[model samples]
Target: MTADARPWTAPVAAGPVTATVRLPGSKSMTARAVVLSALADSPAEILRPLRARDTTLMADGLRALGTRIDTSDPERWTIEPGALRGPATIDVGLAGTVMRFAPPVAALAAGTVTFDGDPHARNRPLRPIIDALRTLGADIDASPSGGLPLVVRGTGTLPGGPAVIDASASSQFVSGLLLSAPRFAKGLTLRHEGPPVPSAPHLRMTTHMLRAAGAVVDESEPDRWVVEPGPTQGRVWTIEPDLSGAAPFFAAALVTGGSVTLGGWPRDSWQPVDTLTGLLTALGAEVTQNDDGLTVRGTGVLHGIDADLSEVSELTPVLAALAALADSPSSLRGVAHIRGHETDRIAALARELNKVGAGIVEHPDGLDITPRPLHAASFETYADHRMAHAAAVLGLAVEGIRLTDVACTSKTLPEFPELWAGLVTGS
Candidate 1:
């Protein structure tokens, strides 16, 4: 079941699924922490980091650039700073973190570091980060196509200064710049232009991590960030549980009229996906926080909702799946940028949902999902983890649903199939 190469039948819950799920650490935080550790002056320890495809890819990418990272313990990473020497090749594996975050670090290498990823990753947004790095004095050749199969020729160091970029497509562009800004000789002052950036919480997460690493960052101005040039100080980092990865389990409760509790749910968090707590409540689930964690109990009544998921577009697939089974229509908007994700989420959702007999419309930036009786079908994952999660949630209510590439969930939650199987069946 861990292998995604073959199709896996999505298990149907016989009744309400009641279980306490313990999620892995945040992939977003793990990737960032790895980057920060590599940039630091001394060795640092990252505890409870997610050990999954995406995060492992990031660790491998950093090692390619001459950073010494120890992965002996899957739960902890020991990073030792080293002189960066490249002529290295990084396989991004459709991980947005590896594709977007590594390039900035590559700019500090002495030689050329080439970046490529899965076929689907070639189509995702890479231009903004490449263009922004070029603007800030990094020698990068992306063939002007600005997608992938790119190279960064590091001059040992960069003279970073004021630069302007459009990050409407992916906030990773802005975060990539900020994360590496401190290594620049002159630091950086980046201003964002064009449409408003999606996933503001992620951007904030970057800033918070940077500050925690002893880097000076200023975000007093809208769409502007200022980072002071300096060496990053090493420190121990503890990654929190991934709220985004918990989406499917929560949706399982609502779908099967069950109850589930998530351990290690942060009392205060910048994770945009934490908004799911409210969304679940609005969907006729009772939510309460206890010493154990966050518990959600479904009353067997699911209600459709109108929600703008622009800031937390990662939740779109599962939410869309839930909406398809709701009592009324639901409109999910402000996530056009997701079109450039691992796959075109909006189109994929509509196409796959309709294949199973749901009335879902793809919009310029969102979806309009109308409640319809859903039947089992072979749900295609498109190699995107969230898409796999959607199929799993829908499968709880609709039997005989075979998820093509359930292995894709390993991108974030490596034990997804095992964890999911346990949650529904109490195995």
Candidate 2:
């Protein structure tokens, strides 16, 4: 009973916008199919799975580590695997995928678990996955500012081999130790020394959903990753549609010149849909894809380019709100770790698109934007759901903007403001 900080005005479109938008599911493949179906061995079935709030706090932190899941079927949930015991406490609510994928499945739980969140999730970065889970043995206590209010102490297992980790500030610490490295005991190799793992397509969708839940994963040694422990064979796990939550309804068809679509979408997409269709076809947006999905029309001229969004960094706040309604300048470099996301999104998109008039500059990793003409202000959203989708694409075309919260778009499009006010009134 929380999310309603009020503010929220952002609606303004009323023009070209066509609209289709179905979106739901794939909050990064439902947090890696709820931590690979809670480290499956048999029972799985996750169908559509994306009931927001960061995949329902990663299935309630793997159901507080005992893992049963069920989720009463929004479309089918089911999980089941148990025996991952723990004195559990996990509430990773600000969810960087439940504080980096539920502390490596609570280090294969046995006793204590703990972990905390939402005070900006203790300045997010969890010391390179708590120093690679203490070099793969896992007894963790972290928080000498390493991040979060940690404590693992589990002793049922976890002695996964070779560690290393410097996931360049979060590739979810090499996908939270390769999604419980096949229930560890000597099943992980992992490498990545430093500086260069910025969402390489979410680590190739975490080694393609850990080789589709059967887990063998070799990755043929580039930044290294071996896996190989054994069991993990769950079964069904559909979830596709969220091409980065269809970037603000395809930036409402490129800021209202109009089309949208995004219905079934998935002509192959583990997210980062061809780098978001080549950054929305280099900001002019025509983006296609058939069988009733991915559309995004708006050629009402918007250009301004330079890109480099480090493997589509969560579509950098709706491509920095379509580069502040582009016409000319935009830079958006390789995302300096989105300044540890959920907040410093390039200094909150250069202080909320230069408080509406947009001229934005603040760069260390990105954002230059320069097309100024916009009016109306307010936009703050530091609670960041992509800064309330860059203040709802700068309120469609800047009217009154507003939006200090928009309930942080319920973490992952909890129906982002009634699907963006029914895509600007085409309701």
Candidate 3:
């Protein structure tokens, strides 16, 4: 999915740079919505399913399982619930959600289901899920590395017992477990026994999706939870705009002293959008929200401060980009979970930022970025979506930025560059 990137150099727009850009639906929430809707026994309405590659792949996977979903409109989905009475084979097309979330959803089927994903997704690790399912009486056959190209043969008689899965790797591991908990005969009890669950709010979103579809969830602690069995009731569901997806724009507002209004944002969201707002405000951004999306305006000068982001690792790259312009040194803490994302985000950010002008310190978990006037430079985006995006935005504060083969954003936002063009020179 690498495309020859058109070389772009960021110029300080002497003229006030201003524009209202349209953002995409949240990939995280959209993927969760698809899964929950598939579990519904009746046709469920999913408003504003993201049209990006990830959600499209998920919708396709569900369709292969005989879940009829109407994808005619980009803004809504009508999901017809059904089952995959395999021998069935489906492809996830490079989406982490499908690779991480599909195993257990398939476990509810009465036959063998072969699941595969995109080339990059094929590299994502799945040992935790495989181990957890094995503990829950699921028979899964996959490569020894515990990667993709998975084969799951459901017993259709799983007596769900105690499951203590280590989620130090990915929160999706815990979410996959929670999504499938309702299908088990004996219900579910889970323990997140490794590093604290990274992206913990995603778990909240997962359980929220499950409960909305009809199930009982009891979250006893940050590390443990119990679920009462229930099949999805398949009600009409609505999808809120992605707050995580909105982080970059919010940070953009903070970086250039520019202002942007975000619409379609959710007031009650597990996404760390609100948290990012506090960080921006701390650094001198004026933020406000109403029925529209959050509106953020940046001040000319920003001061560095201490903050932890282990819970919202996906937003780290954009934060790192913003930190480079802060007056003092800024450190992003609690990011060890970044090691397991689409790429080693901590290392990717540190390496790429250093390529231009910023002084960066890389930790196993997080990074520290210092203020610098960015000069024109070429960069490799590491085929990571966030890396491509955060780097481009960083370039906006510089003389210019030239990104090479930077088309990986298609994994989430297919039209990212087109949107960026409007922001740069106001095309």
Best of the candidates, TM-score:
1
| 110-220: candidate 3 lDDT, tens digit per residue | 788898865666667789888888898888898878877889897555778688888887899988888878778888998888667778778888887787778899996
| Best model per lDDT | 1
lDDT of candidate 1? 0.90
Please identify model 2 stretches exceeding 4 Å from their true place: 1-25, 39-95, 107-122, 125-140, 146-151, 157-235, 243-245, 255-260, 263-291, 294-316, 319-323, 326-343, 346-348, 351-427
Candidate 1 — which residues are off by over 4 angstroms? 1-4
* Colliding pairs, model 2: none
Q: Which digits, one per residue and each the tens of the lDDT, describe model 2 over residues 65-164? A: 8888988878889998888888989888787878888888888889998989788879877898888888888888888888889998888888889988
Global fold similarity of model 3 (TM-score): 0.94
RMSD per model, one decimal? 1.6, 17.8, 2.1
Query: Candidate 1 lDDT, tens digit per residue, 1-427?
Result: 3343768888889999998998999999999999999999999999999999999999999999888999999778899989887889999999988899999889988999998888778888888888888888899988557978988999889999999999999999999889989999999999999999999989999999999999999999999999999999889998888988988998888888888998987777657645777888888888888778888888899999999888889999999999988999999999999999989999999999999988988899999999888897988898888999999888888888898888788899989999999888888
Shift in Å, residue 284, candidate 1: 1.8
Judged by TM-score relative to the true structure, which candidate is superior, 1 or 3? Answer: 1
Task: Order the numbered candidates by lDDT, best leading.
Answer: 1, 2, 3
Candidate 1 TM-score, true structure as reference: 0.97
